[model samples]
Target: MSRATVHFLLRSDLERLFTTLTDNQYEIIGPTVKDGAVLYTPIQHSEQLPQGWQQLQAPGAYRMTRDNSQRYFAWANGPQALKPWLFAPREIIWQAERQPDGSLQFSEPAQPDRKLAFIGLRNCDLAALKLQDQHFLQGQYRDPYYAARRKGLLLIAVNCSHPADTCFCASTGDGPHAKADSEQPGFDLCLTELDDGFLVQSGSEPGDQLLEQLPVSPTTENQLHQQLQQALQAAKQQRALPSLPIKDLLAERRDHPQWDDIAERCLACGNCTQVCPTCFCHAEGEQVSLNSAVSEHTREWASCFSEGHGYMAGHQARPGIRERYQQWMTHKLSYWHDQYGRSGCTGCGRCTTWCPAAIDFPLEVSRICGDDE
Candidate 1:
């Protein structure tokens, strides 16, 4: 409500903000239409932001349509989120070269740290980002790549105005509006999309300083509340995960018949894991040159559903789809609490949206844990 903290930005003002980010040497990345989907790409201008285009997402379904509206950030989430940016899908951790003197030299690629500003971050994405930070930063072995990228990063979040049918971030308490508490800061700059303009708020010191440079007009408390009502109501989504913490309950139902039922429709193609915002499993291997002169150690995203994911002593622990599905579900709702002190799922519904076989995990969880009763 305060003039210094909250402001209104017109279309031209957004362009000015883009210009400011460029001048500050921040690589601006935002949502743009690519290959029939909204994807994060280098944004040079405000016009690159997906405008008048919205998505229809349901279980195992995603399609784009033109609504002829004058609003950006009016659609549900796409296939990806901030996970791929911070926790890269594929990265070379280190490399080794065979030496002439029968000794090997180990080296890492010297890619300079980049100052990145990610725009159009959703509330669920912000929640997912927090979980990612916990995984990569709070662990015994902090990932240098994630730590370096996260340090100089700026997040410009957009409040959800168009939650999809598959979304359940509300039930997860992550929600339509991103929460920034005294303990943990959320986004750098948060925006609520409106028809004529955007309602902006600074969530961090950097955001405050950045907003000072933008061409934004002061907004009143009444105006802010009135406009924010719709975004808050967007949290009342059609889908919701169980409100209760079924961590222990899910573990007890390891042999639930529901697993078999869901597995029949599941292809175990790992589509859900790949699209999920918080799934963090990865496969690491060494890539050796044909001449044995060079070796590169790489880490790439992996899924529990992968046949090789549960390999131990030349035998697959979860070779069947039912076991794999059970493992994925339990880790998300049960094991995550033990690991991160909270659920791993952000309820962005990307897994539900992109799963080719239409395996709706939320409904499946209810059925498996007997929460539907």
Candidate 2:
């Protein structure tokens, strides 16, 4: 394929090309700050990044100030999401040791201690990592620990140029700018932070071998139309609402009375699908043995607003709290776009800033789609 042209690195050669890609072992990841928020860990240099920080979300706040500006896509969506370090809220997947003559060995759970690169990544977190690469790596049930951390990761994307006031990603088409044909070619360097430096591109083949190992330059069709007119006027001044056919209003809000007046200020509290960067749901457990020898089988991160994720056999399938907040806001604004054709809300509002009751999904979707004025 062709489109990979714009390139230019200087921000001190993109911090010596990410400290020589973290001295070649890769693991980098990015955005920092911790505890008082901002997250997306694993940094080890560039002075543990986040210098001067810049968070500031809304609807049930999240602050963090200062922005001395080393520009990395300034700020927006935080409260930690990038989906629990690529889909992991807990894991163990295998272990069964027993034996002294009874026999039971098992094993199987090592791979993944970091090889990634990540960095800055946004654009509704690369459209929620292509919706968890279509539910656990091209679905049909495959998930080998998210396909070995999605094949030892690399993506570097970034391109958001700020948009948060509960951003709407221009109404779910996905993001305040990041489209040069995205589709899980999980970027191997895509940056944008314009104004004078990074507009790099490359997509695969290890982002053309990490752009033949950086220090790149060539980009002048008026600096690639001024970084695509500052990522389309910062996604048209960060558009906020008006777009909710949410797959035909989640196939006509199954018995909607505004889900019982938004379930009395909803608090089934799955902190908006755990700060959804595209919730993938999870849960599994087992950790036996004390001399029967050993046992372990794990998986965490789950919630249709918890309640034993609908326990079973004796019943629990959505038993109030307004039916698990109307099945997680109608499977995220409508049957997750009728079972994933898209629109599972990448409007990165970090679910109204970690919803402690700021429950404002665009003012409950304009009180059930009606007042967009």
Candidate 3:
């Protein structure tokens, strides 16, 4: 439909699009080859992308190769997601200065620049964003820091042109394509890369506004069909992950042996939770002036896998490594939906890829559910 849909040839017109975006003073963040890994980084132009390059990844393994395809998103999910930029690694709470009179003055942390436009966002990441919005934005106690950084940011989602070995987004019912419509718009612009071109559509008012600047033609019937075909093709290649009724499974496996096995290999490390886009858990701390004149509170990212995360009143609730892992998994895969009306895990596969033990989640589920007998 010409009303809001448009198409552009991927090879010829994509660079122009990037140039147009930069012209608007938007800091474009996209995939680039850095230190032999596909990292989401800043790019001055489209030349910085992994042209004719793609990555094949699985638990404990990630490799790059030339695909001979110029698709901007030919590769699957990368190691680092888009969360680090949006949700900072660390932020100063407030700075305080003491005066000669022993009085102290405090200043709040600086907010993020408002003109960042994220490109190559996947469906799983989008779902993760939704989960974070529920926790940080819609909650009774809104996080002013997160709220300020999240506002006025532009989302440029790309449909998965290739599904990775570790991905199970379809099992989570969030994958390959952006499913939300006008009332529930998830992105500003959705790009589906075709063999020679891209199928572009605007999902929100801002998206429509952005689209007007690019040289996009009305989406023809054939392009629409091609878009569906590409999506279905990616979907068909998805590995069949078992649909474990998470709530029931978790309820029965409170003391399962899998916890012990996982702990033995897990290192009690929090890499999975840290890399996860949907993880919103954090802990707060305070710093006081030397003269006790002023105090400033700070919030830092926390994880369930950490030794001190469950600590309360000098006693940690889940002491054992097994117990902590169980709690994290149970909350993420099962109880999170009940508490927040959405699943905590977005099937982004960053957990498996980044874990030292190469912990395959689907394999874990299979172990818990038992194999075909």
Candidate 4:
């Protein structure tokens, strides 16, 4: 219906897509079955995708089941997406060495990142990727590391037909369909998986060129009928974040009793921050050789729950779990709006899924900030 190029790839010819990326020298990463769950891993062949398997997710529960339907990308998402690849969990930003005269020599990592093709990307993660780009690539100071990795990256998004119970991107307006704009933050190509084939829409020049080489067919009206409805259907969620100005509400309730109740249940294990696609808090340190001759400046992911992360110049800003929880929630839901023009959460619900405390985040937010204003 739109001006985007649409094509159909039969179930048997899925391998052509892999071959195209490989020929273009892009390393393929896709969802695979690992350790009883679906995870992103190196996928060279089409057979490596977790076909017919769907992952069921809740606030703190997860299970994988096989439907034997031979469909690829039948799941919503894994614990993490797109973040780790662009933003390394641990990396050496620059290294210093002691010279012969006891002077210091510094050097930054110069290796260019390999081109990457991410298959089965979800729309919620796509939204988060745009936010990450805003943080790293669009500001006064640009991060060379994130910029280098994102330069040659190719995104092959998948529309959700079997989203997890934890998924709430429908309410966030970031999921169930991938945007097809080449001049904007959109996918290179988006695929909607059906029983016998995939409905593919090309969104960029590289994606369009790739489609021209593949053995795809002009989709028929019959093929476009009921087969793709589930993917197009707005995915419903059991939980929803209150659609109001959460900033003033959270500012008003900074010391509310609800904070105490949440602190009692929150383990402050940093699980939520670790899995959060948009959280950018990190700690940098200098690693030195035992002889103190050579040193390397490195940065690693850090969470607000960490006591050290709360340490300010003279004292700790957030000394207790209550304050830490409040800070995380407020920053994610409120501060992000002030900073990014949108909430930090894309509503993928990974923070709730991987939380060991079994904390339902949206429910907690509602209890604390939902209409009793």
Which portions of model 4 miss their true places by more than 4 Å? 1-3, 181-185, 232-234
Backbone clashes in model 3:
0
Q: List the residue pairs that clash in candidate 3.
A: none
Q: Residue 89 in candidate 2 has what lDDT?
A: 84
| Residue 151 displacement (Å), model 3 | 1.0
Q: How close is candidate 1 to the true structure, as a TM-score?
A: 0.95
lDDT of 2 by residue, 21-66 (tens): 8767797778887777778887766666665567677877888787
C-alpha root-mean-square deviation, each candidate: 1.8, 16.0, 2.6, 1.8
Put down candidate 3 lDDT per residue, 184-300, tens digits, no spaces: 658888888887778887888777777788777666788788877878887864454476676668767776778778888887778877888888777777877677666777777
What residue runs in model 2 are displaced by over 4 Å at the alpha carbon? Answer: 1-85, 88-94, 101-108, 117-122, 126-154, 158-167, 170-198, 201-212, 218-221, 228-230, 237-256, 260-281, 287-295, 305-321, 326-364, 368-373
Cα error, residue 339 of model 4, in Å, equals: 0.6
State the C-alpha lDDT per candidate. Answer: 0.86, 0.74, 0.77, 0.85
lDDT of 2 at 329: 70
| TM-score, every prediction | 0.95, 0.41, 0.91, 0.95
- For model 3, give the 10-residue run with minimal summed lDDT: 1-10
How close to the true structure is residue 96 of candidate 3, measured as C-alpha lDDT?
Answer: 74
User: In each prediction, how many residue pairs overlap at the backbone (N, C-alpha, C within less than 3 A)?
Assistant: 0, 0, 0, 0
